[model samples]
Structures are given as structure tokens and as C-alpha cells.
Target: MKPIEITDIDVSYGAKKILEAITFHADAGEILGIVGPNGSGKTTLLKAMTRIVARDNGEIRLDDRDLDSLGHRELARRVAVVPQDISIGFDYSVRDVVMMGRHPYIGRFASETARDVEICDHAMHLANVAALAGASVHDISGGERQRVLIARALAQEPTILLLDEATSNLDVSHQVEILNIIRDLAGEITVVSVFHDLNLAAYYCDRLLLLKDRKVYAAGAPGAVLTRENIREIFGMEMLVKPHPLTGKPYVLPVYMHQSSAGANRRVHVVCGGGTGSDILHLLHAAGFTVTCGVLNVLDTDYGTAMHLGLPCVAEPPFHGITPESLSGLRKCLESADAVIVTAMPIGKGNLDNLRVLLDYPAKPVLFYARDHSTRMEDCTGGEAGAVLANLEARGALRVEGAEELLARLSRDGSDRD
Candidate 1:
């Protein structure tokens, strides 16, 4: 059975309408996530579905029953909501907070029974906040308080759980813990959670509902909903989406704006590490300059980032030790480039001579970022190759400090060619 259903729902706050005919359904034993940017009405939608916010149009049903017809007691027994903004105004104990979820079941003006205490205890344990049961709720951390709230919701014994940015304040490990708990509970109860973290949503949710500007932008499995186009359109940023290696889930990598080559008939060879050179390649391309790179290990973050960006790269197998063949190939790749920029990367024995090869082609201009000579020299195979740089600089190797400077120089070079 569909656990919760919304049909043509429209919600407004005072004079302003927030939701635009939002329609979706959550099935029994399934996990779904609602995601969007700030002020996108994710929380508003949850509130409307839970009857916390009045809906002006459309209908909502819980397990085939009209939601509006349910009384406060009946509604609380059927659906529970954990809001995004969790703030405590009173100094209630953790157990006191959780015990409140039993309000619908208790008789009017009656004290808690033994069963209520047992359920509250189990709920606290389930949320992993049992140790804080006696402590004041307001004194706990955000993550801990969030857990307490979830425990309170669980204590409601509802079949449908609606969570709004439930793990926003949790650390990495706690985030995983809370998500795992929700995932484990999906089979017995229906879950519809709001998540701002795209990676976390993609990893945990069986389906995704993307809301943009208070309307449904997309809805489907993560593979379909979290595409490059959807992300760029909704988030207003360019991103590359790839399947995670271990989980086969979609992962987003933001694409920073880059420059293009303008007038350069010349190409520049960039020795980069840690994906830092990817932007430089784009800049050169924008200025109409060609770029090439080499001796990077295939698994290196920079190498992969470059490869995905479609840069001409000569990459070696990771950690296999750069061999004569790899070095030769690297040199060949840079043969046509007019200049070379050595990015800040640790120089190690395995790939030490990668920089040394530049000395053979002294005719090409070399540029390095203005940095401490001692550190740069140390990375050049224990300073054995540092003298080459010193001699070249003494002769004339330009040092550039910023992207604009490099682009300006390339622009001048381009103008000269014209």
C-alpha cells in the first residue's frame, strides 16, 4: 500500500504561496528523499503533508484514508514529522521529550503508564541517545538533540516518518549512523526525508524528489534525478556526475569556471598535482592556448580530473614508478608546448626526474609560481635538479604569481602572433 499520498497539493504561508501543486507518493517499505536549495519549500512540503501547514488545494491520504478526517490523536498515530529547525525552549529531560510522543495514546489528564516508559526507553535506545535520557534536552549537541527528536517521533509509533534535513548538524560518522538507522527501518516503515547533501541523498535514498523554487523539478532514482543537467539547472553551477566506484551511486564534482586560449599559437605544458591544474588547462583553452601534461599517475586526482576535462595527458600507471618509457612519452607530449608551468606537488623519488626532463628542452620557456626556492628545490630530486632551475632563471625563466598575470602574458603573446 502507498503509505502517504499527496495529490495536487498547494500550500501558502499567509499571502504568499510556496508549493505549486506538488504531487508525489511514498510507498510502504521504501526510502525516498526530498532535496533542493534553501527556501525551496522542502520543509514546507513536509509540514503540509503532516497537516502542520494548511493546504489550500488538493488532497492527502495516509494508507488510503483521508488525512483531513483524522483527529489529532489519529493523525499522530499515523504520521510523525521531524522538523528541520529543532530548538528546545524548555529544560525538559531527554526522556520527557520522547515521552511526549505518546500523547495521542494517553488518557486526558492521566499520568504515563508503565508501557509508555518502556516504549520511550526503547525509542531512546533506537536513536542511540539512551545515555542522555536523564540529561536536559537543551544541553545536548545538535546531532544529539536531533537524535532525541527522532526518538520522540519513533516513539509516536507512526507508520510514516517525515524528516526535514534530519542529519544537517551531524558529523560525518553520525550522519552515517542516522542514515543507516533510517535505511534499516525502511522495510517496516515508510520514510521520506529531506536532505541537502547530494552525495548523502544519492547514497541512502531509493528514490529522489528534487524541488526547485517550491515546485517539483524532477523525481526518479538517483541515477536519473541527480544528472549533470538537473544539478546545473537547479543549483546554478556546472558539475560532473560520475558513478561511485564502490556503491555505483552518482557523485558530483563541481566544475569551476576556466579561461580559454586567445591568440597563442603556442601550447603550455603544466606539471600539476591534486587536480589543481585542471582550471589552468581551461584558462589556457579559453585564451586559445593549447595545453599538455605528463608523468602523472592514472589514479592521481589531478590526472583523473584532467582526463574527465579532456586534457591531453600522458599518465603512468599509479605507483608503478615512472619508467624510461613514461618519461619519454611525457617529453613527447610537451614537445610542441611553448611554455611549462610546474604546479606545487611534492617531489619524490618515484617520479623525481619528471621535472628534470625540462632541462633537456631549455629552448622552451618555463614558469613556476613564485614560491620558496628551498622547498621547490627539495622536490627537484633533493636539489640535484634545482641548479638547472637556478641557471634557467638566471638566464630567463619567468615566474608568474597569479592567473590574471599568466593570462595577460598569454594575451600579449597572442597579440604579437596576430
Candidate 2:
């Protein structure tokens, strides 16, 4: 039987609606994650499942049992929650806090049993908080306290576990530690968690439910639900949703957007190879500049960056010299450009012609750009490349350092092609 099933639920706070038409299910022994931006009702959904808040309409079932049919104590015995963090007003011992999870089982008239103590001990050990059993909850760090909460949840021995970004308050090391523990427990206990970190969700979750504006936006495997288009549409920002190199899971990276159209209508041609041009290429494109790049081989890193950014580029096949067709394309780009910026990439025999072509544009404004003062152009073409650079600098190629300076210079120039 499925561990969780919710259908057509709606939630609201007085007059303000929070969630609408939300429906999904979690399979037994699988980790399902709910991810969405703030105010999208991620926490509220969790609360509804546990009856912390009333759902306006819908059915919620656990293992085919109606949610309303379960008594408070029965629900507590079957479901456990690890919250983001809790305010510890009283200085309770760590063991005291974990023992509370067993209250739903213990009889009201009876004393504490030996089996209860054993369960608490085992839960603490599982959560890595056994070493701090006697410490005050307030005395330990936030991370330790979070683990204590996990241990408490584990002590309940629930069939389903809920975590509301339980590790959000901890440091990276502690976050990973707790997440590792949760992942290890996935098969033994069905986990339904709210995740702020999409990358973590991608790696750990068997499936995902995406929420937007209080409604279910998408639901499926991480790769399908976390696509570039889906993220852009929901979050209202562009992002690079590529696979993580190590885990081969979808990795989301923000496409840093610059708000100003400072270089609008101005054209700049970039002469770059290797991976040196990716940053500036994105910067210029994002700032609303008419940017063009290349005479790079198709296999070059910068070529890939240009393609990814959808910039106009001229390219040739890898390991081949710049063909007549590509050189003509580069010349046309240079002719139309208001300025030119060259990056500090290695000067190889195949690309020495790139520098040679720059000498023909003496009248055009030019800048030798670098990420920093420490990065100099690698002249692999013997002194031949050196001689070409010396000649270009002699004519009027201004040496500009850093992306900001290059952008500032380009932004300041409003003149069209001379």
C-alpha cells in the first residue's frame, strides 16, 4: 500500500488562500520531496498532513486509512515530524526530549517501561546523538539539537517520517550528516520532506512534487520536474539545470542576471579561446550588449559557452586552422563591432592567426582583457605570438583588466562603428 495519498486539498489562512487543488502520493519505502519557493505552502502542506492545520477540502490517507479516522495518539504513533528547529524554553535533558516520542504508546496509568527506554537508546544511537544523551538540549549546538529532534522522531518508530527542511539551520557539514542519516532510513521508513535545496532533492528524492503559488505545478522524477523551462516559469528567473558531475543528478545553478541594459545597441566582438571567455560572454549578453565571439574550434570550451549562451559565433572544426569561411565571418563581426575585447588564453600555432587578424583593426577600439593582473596571455606560438601582441599594443590596443572594467568601458562608449 502507498504510504501517503492526498487528493484535491485546499488550505487558507482566514481570507488569504495558501494551497489549492494539491494532489500527490508517496509510495511505500521511497523518499518523496516537496519543493517550492517561500509562501508556496510547503510547510503548510506538511502541517495539513499531520492535522496541525485544517484542509478546506480533500481526502488524506495513510496506508489506505482515512486521515480523519485515525485518533491523535494513533496518528502520532504512525507518523513523525522533524521540524526546522524548535525553541527550547525549558532546559530539558536530551534523553528527556527523545523519550516524549514514546508517549503515544505508553499507557496513561502505567510507569515507564524497559522497552521504551531501549527504543529511546536505539533512536539516539541511530541519530548520532547517543553520545549526548545527558546534555541539556539548550546547552548543545543547533545542529546537535536538530539531531536530537531526529532521534525523537525515530523513537516513535513511525511508518512515515516528515522533515521540514530539518537541517536548514545547521552548517554544511552537519546538514550533510543529517541528510545522510535520513537517506539511509528511506527504505525502512517512507520519508516525505520539504526541501529548499533543489540539488539535494535531485540527488536524494525518488520523486518530487513541485508547488507554485499555492497550487501543484509539476510532479514526477527530478529530471522531468526540475527542467530549465519549469524552473524558469515557476521561479521567474533563468537557471542552468545541468547534471551534477559526480552524482549525475540534475544540478540547478542561477543564471546571474544583470538588471541594467547598460550596453544596449552597442556591439562588441570577443576574440577568445579555451574557457577564458565564458564569464564575460555571459556578462555582456546579460547586460543587453550585442555580443559576438570566436574563430574558435568547435571543440573549444569557449565555443561551448557561446553555444550555451546562444551568442553569435564563428567556428571551425577542432584541430584545424581557421578556414577561409570562418575568417571572413570574423572579419564581418569585427567590421560591425564598436569595440573588441581579447581574453588571456593560450596562443597556440592553430590560433596564432587570431592575433594576426587583430592587427588589421588598428582604427577600431580594442582592449586586452584578463580576469586579474596575475593572468597573462600564454604565448605558445614562440616569440611570434609575442611579436603580434607587441605590435597590437603599440598601435592602440588598450590593456583593460577585469570584467567590470571591460563592461564599464563598453557601457561608456555610445558611438557606433567608425
Cα RMSD, each candidate: 5.2, 2.0
Q: What is the C-alpha lDDT of each candidate?
A: 0.81, 0.91
RMSD of 2: 2.0
Could you give candidate 2's per-residue lDDT for residues 134-230 as a string of tens digits? 9999899999999999999999999999999998878888988998999999999999999998888998899999999999999999999999889
Candidate 1 segments exceeding 4 Å error: 244-248, 256-267, 271-303, 307-338, 342-363, 368-418
Best by TM-score: 2
- Return the TM-score for each candidate structure: 0.75, 0.94
Worst 10 residues of 1 by lDDT: 369-378
Cα displacement (Å) at residue 295, model 2: 2.5
Pairs of residues clashing in candidate 2 = none
Worst 10 residues of 2 by lDDT: 409-418
Q: Which parts of model 2 are misplaced by more than 4 Å?
A: 317-320, 411-418
Per-residue lDDT for 56-174 in model 1, tens only?
A: 99999898899889998999988887775477888999999999999999989898999999999998998899999999987888878888888999999989998888888779888
